[model samples]
Target: MNVAVIGGGGREHALARKLAQSDRIETVYAIPGNDGMRDVAEVVPEIGETDFEKIAALCTSKQVAWVVVGPEAPLSEGIADYLEGRGIKVFGPRKEEAKIESSKAFTKDIMEKYDIPTARYKAFTDYDAAYSYIESVGAPIVLKKDGLAAGKGVIVATDMDEALAGLDALMADSDAPIVIEEFLEGEEFSLMVLVNGDYTHSFEIIAQDHKRAFDNDEGPNTGGMGAYAPVRHIPESVRQEAVDQIVGPMARAMVSEGLDYFGVLYLGAIVTDKGVKTIEFNARFGDPEAQILLSLMEDDLVDVLEKVDRKEAFTLTFSPRYQVGVMLASAGYPGSYDKGHTIDFEAVREKSFVSGLKQENEGWVTAGGRVLLVTGEGETIESAIDSAYHNVDQVKFNEGEVFIRRDIGRHALK
Candidate 1:
């Protein structure tokens, strides 16, 4: 089968690599793909994700059997709906279901309506009203922008003063609406599920991403610093509860609301003393998490995605091994930074054994603002982190342009 993956990030590169290894796949194509994907698939340059008509035409012409939407922006723009409406098979949720990630206020409202476990939040379009609410709520609040702000929309304020500043920044200067939520204290985890409206299959629960730019959980938030699978922090009982109370309920609620959500349902969850509560919902896969999950997935990528797109029931087997992924970004990332910086991967690959799997050097190249994802798999999370960091240390870029978190799997270590 011929498959096409949309987006130009490390996540898409990982997906392309996995699909290329499938025995049943004849060819894989990536639209506007990065340099890393060149070794695994044919990179098409003309069809931008937002240009639906052009992309659809390319798919038809290329005889692409399946289309995988990678990023949230295009999915939120309804690319899946447009493709499916044209009788094309696509692995992504429709635009209506995508509101769960695109609009924070809408997601909070839906959670309240369906009784989904989540942090208490109040929405405001008026700046003064939101400021007043923040004062009442007091310090240590979570401020979120209603519209998409890349991954920096949500802010965890340390005090009332910081909370007010965040509100003003999001509502006053920015045209986007703001959502001020009660800050919930807990360790976080990421849960990804495959949903076909009526049926859903969950992957192994993994530790949450380190969104901050530096190590020791300090500094401003970036898209993500790194992540690992099979988080030891979450007990089996807690994971089961999350599946039952969070993932399953959210899937059912979306189906009941007349939205036939098909494809990946990414949930950002907090394991609070009161049980698990959802921090946010994403219609597609998570970045660094996706990299680690795909590394540990033993099933054929084509088979799993096709089943979901066809709305057929299926199960996936995961390797017992743990996987860790470390992201290397340009220094000023999550802010303004230089692009097109040259990277050297030869020294990086020699640092560790990554699952004992070897690949051609053509796969190593700078793809996005966040350039490379150094991953490792081991029998335990400790070994995985050790292996991943070993490889991450060897990579080099322009001076003062490389930034990554050093404590990707520390929670699991504890």
Candidate 2:
């Protein structure tokens, strides 16, 4: 069987590698796949991920048995519906369901209606009203763009000036509604659940991503700097509380509303004083988190997806070792950065997943903000973190136009 994965990033790279591990899978095709995926998948650079018509054509031509949507943008645009209309099976949710991630207001309403634990928030389209509300609420408030901003739309303004500036910038960027809410203090973690609108499964392991671009959790938020799985400090009881209160209720509520939901449900939640409350919801897998979590999986990813699609219970397995992954980004990432600096991946090619690369006769060069993710595993999170950084040290970027956060797994520091 052949499978096609949509998206050209480190997350898709991890999905391709795992999908290729399935015995039933004959070939894995990465739609507009990056150069790093060539070893694991047939790169189809002629087509773009969000081009629904061309994606259907490629699926038909390649005889792709199943298509896994790796990113939220294509899913939000109803790639699942388009592909399914042409007799192809998709692993992501439909258009309406994808609104959970595409539009912050959509998910906020559902959370309020379902009595799910989340932050106290209000949505606004008028710029004046949003700014007024921010002033009324005061500082240490959270501001989010109603639509997708590649995970960087949120601003945790600490002062009144910062809040007003963030609101201005957000209002200027898009005409969409702005979400402002009271900041909830707690530790944040990523919980990615697999659901088919009926059955939902929460993994025993949970991963936490460092969103800030620099060490000590300072600097602006990037997509994700790094991540580690099986957050031992979180405790099993807290995870269960999250599933019972947030993940399970939301899935059932969507079903109650007659929305056909499927695929991964990424919960960006915080363990606050009031318990687990959702910060945001993403329709697909998290980037660096997927890189680490997928590595620990002992089961075939295809089988898991099939079971979820069938709405049957699945008992998945995992490696006992803790997994860690750190992203190597082009300098000045999560902002403006230089690219086309030559780099090498041969040393860590097997164990690392490369992204944002432009192949040339000389070698591959940096092509995107996040260049690649280097992962490592160990019996302990500390060792796992060490191993990942050790591999990262060997990689050399021409002109040294690269930046990496050193304290990726600091929370697990003993």
Candidate 3:
């Protein structure tokens, strides 16, 4: 079977690699795939990921059996609806379902409707109203742009001044509405569940992503600095409760609301002292989290995704070893930074997943904030982190324009 994966990032690369592992899959195609995927799939750079018409045409022309939508943008833009309308099987949620991620306010509203456990919040279009509410509530709150802003749209402000500044910045852009909410304190983890509209599904082994840009959870959040699978912080009982109270309810609620959501339902949650409370919902797989999850997966990904499309029942098996993925980002990442720096992936020994790169006569140069994610697997979390960083050290970028967190899986050690 021929498969096409949309999006050009670490998550897409991981998907492409996992698909290639299926003996049933004869060929895999990536639309504008990164350099790391060159060995595993045929990269089609002719059309952008959101170009639904061309993508549909390509699928028909190549007789591609399945198209997996990776990033949130195209999904939010109704790419899945467009492709499915053209009779192409897509492994993603439709635009309406994708609103769970594309619009924070929408998800919060659903949470409120379903009695789902989440932070108290109010969505605001006016800056002054938002500011007044924040002042009334006091600080240590979360300010989120109601719409998607990559992963940089959120500010966990500890004071009024910071809250106002974040509100002002986001409100300046009329397109960006803001959500001010009470901040839930606890250890956060990523729970990616595979669900059909029926609410029947299975959960992937839990993986935790470090969102802060720097070491020790300091600094502003980036897309994700690194991730590790089978997190110890979330005990089995807690995970099960999350599945029953969070994932299951969310899925059933979407169904009740008349949404046909299929594919990955990414739930970002915190293990609070009171219990697990949702942080956010994403329509697709988490980036660095996907890298580690795929590394530990023993099941044929194509089979699982096909089952998701068909809403069939299946179980997932995973390797026992821990998998850690450390992101090597551009120096000023999650902010303005230089691009087009040359890189050499072959020199690195660990498995490298490229998130951003452009091929030139000179070599592959960085094209996005996060350049690459180098992953390592081992019997222990310490060993995995060691392996990941060891390989990360070998890869080089021209002008030393890359910065990596020295303590990716350090929390696991503690």
Predicted structure with the largest lDDT when compared to the true one: 2
Worst 10 residues of 1 by lDDT: 350-359
lDDT of 3 by residue, 87-129 (tens): 9988899999999999999999999999999999999987778
Clash pairs, model 3 backbone: none
Top TM-score: which candidate number? 2
Better candidate number, 2 or 3, judged by lDDT: 2
Number of the candidate with higher lDDT, 1 or 3: 3
TM-score of 2: 0.98
What order do you get sorting by TM-score, best first? 2, 3, 1
* Collision count for each candidate, in order: 0, 0, 0
For each candidate, the alpha-carbon lDDT, in order, equals: 0.79, 0.89, 0.86
- Please, what is the TM-score per model? 0.93, 0.98, 0.97
lDDT of 2 by residue, 25-62 (tens): 99999998888888889989989989999999889988
- Give the clash total for candidate 3: 0
lDDT score, candidate 2, position 11: 93
Judging by TM-score, tell me the better candidate of 2 and 3.
2
lDDT of 3: 0.86
